[model samples]
Target chain A: MSTTEMTVHAFTRMLERHGADASRWPERQAAERLVVRDAKARQLLEEARGLEDLLRASLPVPNPTAARMRADVRGRLSTGPSQQLIDWFDRGPLWRPLMAALLPLGLGFVLGLGFPEPAADDDLIAAVSLLAFDQGTYLDESLNASVEGGEYAP
Target chain B: MARVQARDSEALEHLMVRHGGALHSYLYRMNPNPSDVDELGQEAFLRVWQHAGRWRPERARFSTWLFRIGHNLCIDRHRKYRWIAPIKTDETVETAEPTSLRRAPDQAFEEEQRRQAVRRAVAELPERQRSALLLCQFHGMSNQQVADILEISLAAVESLLARARRALKEQLVQFINTDQATQ
Candidate 1:
C-alpha cells in the first residue's frame, strides 16, 4: 500500500478500536486533522459516528435522583459489626493469615475431641473372646450330632 | 475513602452523590428492570461503605473500584435470576411515539424500529461483551479501565468490544444502510 493508503488504513483501525471520537484516539491531534482533510477517512469517521448514535439512542434514560438508593445503602451501612468484620477480614493483614493458619488445626482438634478413640486392649480382647466362643460352640455341636448318630464309634 | 473508613457519613454522602448516578445508570443498563437496578446499586454502595478501609488507591482508581463492585453485583444478580427478566422496550416505544407523531410518520416508525432492534441486539450480546461495550462507550472508560473493572486483560477487553461492535453492526446493518441512504 502507498503511504497515504497505509495511513488511512491505520486511521480506520484506530476508529474501530476507539469509537467515533477522535479525541479519545491515541494518535490524538494528527489523526483528527487527517480525518478533517481526507474525504474517505471522514466518511469512515461518519460511519463510526452512526454506530455510536445508534448505541446512544438505544440506551434508556436512567433515573437521575439517587436519594432512595443512597438511603437504602446507608441503612444497610448503619447496621452492626458485620461490615467492620468484613473490612477487618479484607484489610487486616495479620489476623487473616493467622486465622488461615489456625483453621485446619482448629478443625482437627475439634474432630479429635468429638470422636475419642476406644482402649486398644479392650477392643482386641472382645474380638478374640467372641471368636473363641463361636469356635467352641461349633465343635461341641458337631461332636454331639456325630455321637448321637454313632458315626464316631471309637 | 479514608474519611468513610473513619465513619464519616458526610464523606460517604459526598462519594455517593458523585458516583451514585453513574453506578445506577450502569446497573440499569446491565439489567433494564428499575427495581433490580435500585437493589443492585444499593448493594454496590453498601459494599463500598463496608469495604472503604480496604480501598487501596495504588490498586485502582476509586471509580474503577466502585464500578467493579457494581459489575460484580450485576453478574451475581444475572446468575441468580439467570437473566429471566426481559428488556423493558415497550415503555420506551410508547414514550417515543408521542414525540415522534410531530415528525414524519415513516421516519419516526423506522427510527423506533431501529431503536428496538438495537436494544434487542445489545441485550443478546454475551455478558462480558455487553459489559465491555457499555463501560467503554457509555461510561466513557478507557480500555484499560474496563480491563481493570472486569478483571480481564486489556487484549481481552479489546477483543470483547470488537466482537460486540461487529455483532451490533451486523444486526443493525439494514437500518444503518437505510439511515445513511436517507442522510
Candidate 2:
C-alpha cells in the first residue's frame, strides 16, 4: 500500500500495478534491486511473472467477432428500440396479433348471430324504398333532359 | 466520442470496432458464457449510444465511462438475475489456441490443459477480484482505470488484483512451473 517508499510491499504493489513486466515499472531499478536482494521480493516477482504469463498465454486473441459485433451494434443503434420492437414482431409468427386485432370483429359477428336483431318498421322500409324509387325517377328524368341538351353531351 | 455523443451511428460503429473486442474480452472474463458476452457487449455499446448525452468528457475518459456502464450492467444483471453463469472454461482454451503453439500433439494438448486450468482458477476468484484480474490481464487496463470502471478505490483494486493473482498463481503453480521449466 505504501507505494511512495521503496519497500518490499511497494515492490509487490508495483508488480500488481504493472504486472511482472519490470520494464514497465516506474521504479524499475529499485524493484529489480529488491528482486535481486530480497528473497520474498524475488518469490513475489516469480509468482507474479507466472500469473502474468499464464494470463497472457491464455488470453483470447482479438478475432473477427469484433467486426461482427460492431455490425450488430451498428444495426441495433440505427434501428433504435422502436425498430427493434417491430423486428421482434416480425420475428414472431404473424397470425397472433392479426387474430388479436380481429377478435373484436369476430366477437361482434358471433354476438350478432347469437342475439335476435330488432325488426325494422314496415313504414320505415316503405319510405326507404319510395325514396329510392323517386331518386331513380329523378335521375332518369335528368339524364333524359341532359341527353336532349347538346351542351351536356359526353 | 464527440461524434458518438452527437447521435452519429457511424461514430458509434467506429467506437464499437475500436473497443468492441476489448469489451467482449472483459465481458468474457466476467461471464465466460459466449451468449452472455455478446449480449453484454452489444448492450454496452447500445448504452453508450443511448446515454452519450450524459457523458461529461472532462469528468472521466470515454473508455472509463463506457466500461463503467458495462460494469454496472454486469452487476445489475447479476443482482437481478443471480449472476452470470459460471464459465464452462472448456471453450476459452480452444478459442485462444495460439497458432505458434501448433507443434507436437502431446505438448499442444498439455498447453491447452494448462490454459484451461488458468481459466478455471480465474473463474473461481471472487467477483471483484475476477473483474480486476480480467480487466487488467485481458485489456491491460491500469489499476486506476479498473478502479474507475469498478467504482472502487485504487487501493481496493490493487488488493483485488493481488489476491486474484495470488490465487491463480497457487492454483496454476504446476502449469507455471512447467512453463518456467520450458523457458
Candidate 3:
C-alpha cells in the first residue's frame, strides 16, 4: 500500500480547483499536477478529464433544431381546454372527484349522529342483518338436535 | 409559480430558449437515445406546468428548480428502467441528425470515436456519481448548484463526482491501451 494514495477529498479539491471554470485552463492544469503526483490517482483524473473534454467537444455546438420543443412549449402555452384537461389529469387519478366523494361521505357521517336515520340501501348493514338471522337459525337447530339426542333434553 | 404561472408564456418561452440547449445536452449525454432525451425533457416541463403554483422565487432560481426537476426525472427514469447501454466506441449514434457544422473528415471520425468512448464511460458509472459529474463537468454547473439540483450535501456531490471521474479514467485508460495493443 503506497502511503501517498490521495484521499477522495484531495482529488475533489483538485477537481474544484481546476474545474471551477470551463474556459479556464488552470483547473485542467491543476488536475494534471495531481495526476503527476500520484500515479494511479493521476491516471484516473486524466481519464476523467479526457471524458470531460469529449463531452465538451462532442456537445452539438450548433444549437439542435428545437421545432418540436418549441411547438411543445407553444402548444402547452396556448389558452385552451387541452392544457386545462392535461393539467387536471396530471393531478393524478381523479383526485378531485375522489375528494368530492369523500366529502359527502364525511358529511353523511357527521349528519348521521344528529339526524333521524334515513332508509338507504347499505350493503354492509344488509349483510350484518342477514348474518344475525343465520346465526339465530343455527342456534335453534343446534338446540333442537340436542333435545332429540337427549343430551340436554331436561 | 411566483409570477410566471400559466399566464407567463413569455417567461416560459424565455426559459425554454435560454436553458433548453443545456438541458437537452444533459439529457442527451445521460441517455444515448434522442427519443429518450426528448421524452424526458418534455416530461420535466410537464412537471413544471403541473407545479407552476409551487415555484418559489425566494428559495431557488427558476432555472435551478427547472434543472433539479430535470435531474430528478432522469435519475428516476434510469432507475425505473436501465436505458443507458455500456459505453463503447463502436456503438452507433442514433436519434440526432448530424449537426450542420462540418469538420475535416479524419478529425470528425476521430472526434466521433472519442465521444462514443466517453459516453460509454459515463454510462458505466454509478448513477449518482455520473449525474453529479455531468452536472458539474459537462453542464458547467457549480458545486453549490449541483448540490442544490441533486438535493445532496456539497460534500456528497464532491465525493460522487470524484468517484465518477476515477471510474471514467480507468475505463478510458483500458480503452486506449487496448486500442494501442490492437494497432
Task: Point to the candidate with the largest TM-score.
Answer: 1
Instruction: Compose the digit string of candidate 2's lDDT tens values, residues A11-30.
Output: 87688667887666778877
The better candidate by TM-score, 1 or 3, is 1
lDDT of 3 by residue, B1-183 (tens): 444586675666666677787888777766646666777777677677668888888877777888898887777666556566554343343424457766689866865776666666667787778778777776667777888888989788877866776666666765555444433
Model 2 off-target regions past 4 Å?
A: A1-10, A16-18, A23-26, A38-40, A61-64, A78-154, B89-101
What lDDT score is found at residue A130 in candidate 3? 99
lDDT (tens digit, per residue) of candidate 1 on B22-132: 988787777888877787777777778778889999999999999999998788667655654556775533343355456677866777788788888888999999899
Standalone chain B TM-score for every prediction: 0.91, 0.88, 0.76
Ranking by DockQ: 1, 2, 3
Q: Candidate 2 residues B49-140, lDDT tens each?
A: 87889999888888888888888767755765576565564543446446885779898788778767776777778889988887877676
State how far residue A147 of model 2 sits from its true place (Å): 95
> Each predicted complex: what DockQ?
0.25, 0.19, 0.15
The best candidate by lDDT is 1
**What residue pairs clash in candidate 1, if any at all?**
none
* Tens-digit lDDT track of model 3 for A6-89: 554666566643453425333454444556777776554544455565456544433444567867767765648876666554
- Runs in model 1 lying further than 4 Å from the true structure: A1-6, A33-39, A80-113, A118-154, B84-86, B90-109
In order, candidate lDDTs are 0.80, 0.76, 0.65
Instruction: Output the worst ten-in-a-row residue range by lDDT, candidate 3 chain B.
Output: B87-96
- CAPRI level of candidate 2: incorrect
